[model samples]
Target: MPQIAILQMCSGIDPDANLAVIEDAAKQCAEQGALALFTPEMSLLLDRDRARARAWIESDGPSEMIDRISEIAAKQHLEIAIGSMPVATAGGKWANRSHYFRPDLAPPITYDKIHMFDVALATGEAWRESAAYEPGRAVVTVEDTPVGRLGLSICYDMRFPALYEALGNRRCDCIAVPAAFTVPTGRAHWHTLLRARAIEASAFVIAPAQVGHHADGRETFGHSLVVDPWGEVLLDMGGDASGLAFCEIDLNRIAEVRAQVPALANRRPIPKS
Candidate 1:
């Protein structure tokens, strides 16, 4: 059984304050024998004020905060998955990117979020992610990690089954669906989608989420979850607070569940009309 830690955060506008939270979480995860620490979307900064956020966004190179995270990983000898952060793109737009840092201090694996969240809800809340962020072009998976084969996807990307299908095709053992979901949508669809994705891929789904009221005056539905391959909810952190929790992932469960259902193997491609 591999142990992983989930850090549910109510991130604020200041990047430095958020970094302190991450640093403490990394230390706790290391002390508790967690191989990796997974955080929610915009783990470093969650300001809805794009102009204020732009000041902290870096352009795919050496970043002070990122470098500090690398140092933290190196010092703690732990893997850290920063769910998503704002990155400046060469094409004059920004990318909502996820980064994976290893204890060995090698280059981090980066995954840009593919699907943009553009919607208007009944609650009078609207998000137009595509207005500022560019959608990623490729599916990303990292092999030989603590969780075996790890697939990566951001919040809105989880709504698309095709992305999970691609990950299922790759036979990923676990998928990370880090999110900062709105209160209304999270209440209605968060758990359902996560469980469905786990069952569809026949793999474990680990989702670390953002919770509570934020510094940007937006509220999120927390309930950070870890669902098993058979759609069993192993852990639910609830919706009220921000904290760190640990879960033991049994790698053997993957083979057992796949042997029982074989959904990934039985999956047939749908033909276009």
Candidate 2:
């Protein structure tokens, strides 16, 4: 079984500052014997200005932040999952992408967020992610170190259980939900939703979240967590703060839980209304 670490980030507009915070957290996780470290969404820059965000986005290869983190991963010989970033893609559109970096590889495997957050919150806060990001069309499941098979997703995808069910059906033992959840939604749905996904799928749910206020005056709920296969939160950092939480995952527990309950196997197709 692999040990995992989740990094809770209160990243501002400064990319350099965010990198520094991540470096510190990664070092701590490595020292704590974490085989894989995960960061929150918008790992590099968290600016609200669409124009400024567009200016900072990169087309291909590695951005400054990615380069720095890649170097760190190689030096430490650690696997990393970067939460999300705004990357310039083809057709004059940007992608909200999550990166998975292996220590020995020059380039990381990237997964663009499939679900775009284009909705109005209960607090009258609205986000038109489609305006800035091109939606991804593929379901990504990677066989990585420490963890056997890992599935990747961004914030808004949390609301959709079908996606996770698909991942579990594909034999994903672990799922990463890197998010910048709003205060209203996070407070109400964050833990419950995460736990439900874990219980339903019988997999470990590792979520590193963005908490506190951003440069855009957007408030996010920060309670970065690592939940086990049994829906028990093993490590949780409550409130808004930049820190690292470590957990030793027992892979066998996943099989045990699934064998005991087997709800996933019992799922049936429902007729469309």
Candidate 3:
């Protein structure tokens, strides 16, 4: 059983403050014997004001925040999965990117969030992620980690079953769905969708999340979850606060669930309409 840690955060507008939280969590994860530490989306900064946040968002070369995280990972000798951050692209659009940092000299593996969250809510809250972020085109997976082959996806991507289907097809052992979800949406769909994805993929779903009111006047639903292949909820850090939580990944459970359901093996490609 490999134990992993999740940092459920109420990240603010300050990048340095966020980095301090992560650095402390990394130290704690190392001390607690965790193989990896998973954090919520926008772990470094969660400001909704694009103009105010523009200064910290990285474009060319590695930003100080990224360098600090890399150093932290290396120093702690622990794998750290930074849920997502805003990174400027060459195309003049920013990317909501997830980065996986290893303890070794190996380079960090990154996955740009593919699904853009552009929606108008019943609560009158609206988001236009596509208006600023460049959507990713590729499906990314990293091999030989604490959880075997790990698939990467961000907040909105969890809503699209096809993305999980693709990850399922690749036989991932665990999938990361880091999110900074709004209260209304997270309440209605968070657990159900995460469990469904875990069941469908026959894999563990690790989701670290943002919780409580943010500095930018936004609130997030934060039941940071770890669901098993059998769709069992292993851990749920309630929405009330920000903190660190741990869960053990039973690697054998993957084979057991797949052996029972075998959904991935039985999947047939659908004909185009």
Candidate 4:
């Protein structure tokens, strides 16, 4: 069993500052024998002003955060999964993406968030993520990792069962859902959605979340979760504060759960309407 760390953060507008937080957290996680460290969404920048954030984003060149992460991963022989960052791309649009970096700092396996959160919530909070980001076209899974094969998804993507189903079909042993979710939705659905995904896929689910109020004037519900293949909540860092939590991951649990449930193998497509 390998221990994994989840860094719950309260990121603000400054990318450098956020990167510092991650670097420090990574060092701590590595020293503590964590195989991998997962961060919440918008780990680099969490600003309400999309234009301001885009101005700070990078298309190419040596990103300070990535560089620091590379050094940390190589030095500690750790695996780091960044929840989301603003990546400049074609047409002058940015993609909200997650990046997976290994001990060798091999070119990161990146996954752009496929589901754009465009909704006005009952909490009077409105987020038009599509306005700032282009939805990703590909579903990504990284095969080489200390933990078994890993499937990648961002915050909002967890709402779509089909995505998890697809990852499960690919036989992913673990799924990462990094998020900066609102209080209302997180309170009501965080645990339920995470546990459901794990149970449905027979895979371990790791979710690191942003917590507390940020400089953007928006608040995020903070309850970083580590769920088992059997839908058991192994660890839940409560919403009270931001910090780190560790969980031991046994890939054999996935096989055990799948053998008993056999849910993934029983799936049948519904008739097209």
Whose lDDT is greatest here? 3
lDDT of 2 by residue, 113-186 (tens): 98888989777999998987888887888785588799988888989998898988887888999999988888
Q: By the TM-score metric, which is better: model 1 or model 4? A: 1
User: Per-residue lDDT of 1-273 in model 3, one digit per residue for the tens?
Assistant: 999999999999988888899999999999999999999999998989998787667533336667788899999989999999899999998999999999884668999999999999988999999988999999999999999999999999998999999999999999999999999999899999999999999999999999999999999999999999999999999999999998999999999999999899999989999
The lowest-lDDT stretch of 10 consecutive residues in candidate 2 is 53-62
* Local accuracy of candidate 4 as per-residue lDDT tens digits, 1-273: 899999999999988788889888888987899989999999988988876675677534227667777888898788999998888877667888899999886778899999999989876888888886899999899896767899999999999998999999999999999999999999899999999999998999999999999999989999999999999999999898888888899989988998998988998988999
What's the TM-score of each model vs. the native?
0.98, 0.94, 0.98, 0.96
- Provide the RMSD of all predictions against the true structure, rounded to 1 decimal: 1.3, 1.7, 1.2, 1.4
lDDT of 1: 0.93
The count of backbone overlaps in candidate 3 is: 0
Q: Which consecutive 10 residues in model 1 have the weakest lDDT in total?
A: 55-64
Regions of candidate 2 where Cα sits further than 4 Å from its true position: 58-62
Report how far off residue 105 is in candidate 3 (Å): 3.6
- lDDT accuracy of residue 236 in candidate 4: 93
Better of 3 and 4 by TM-score: 3
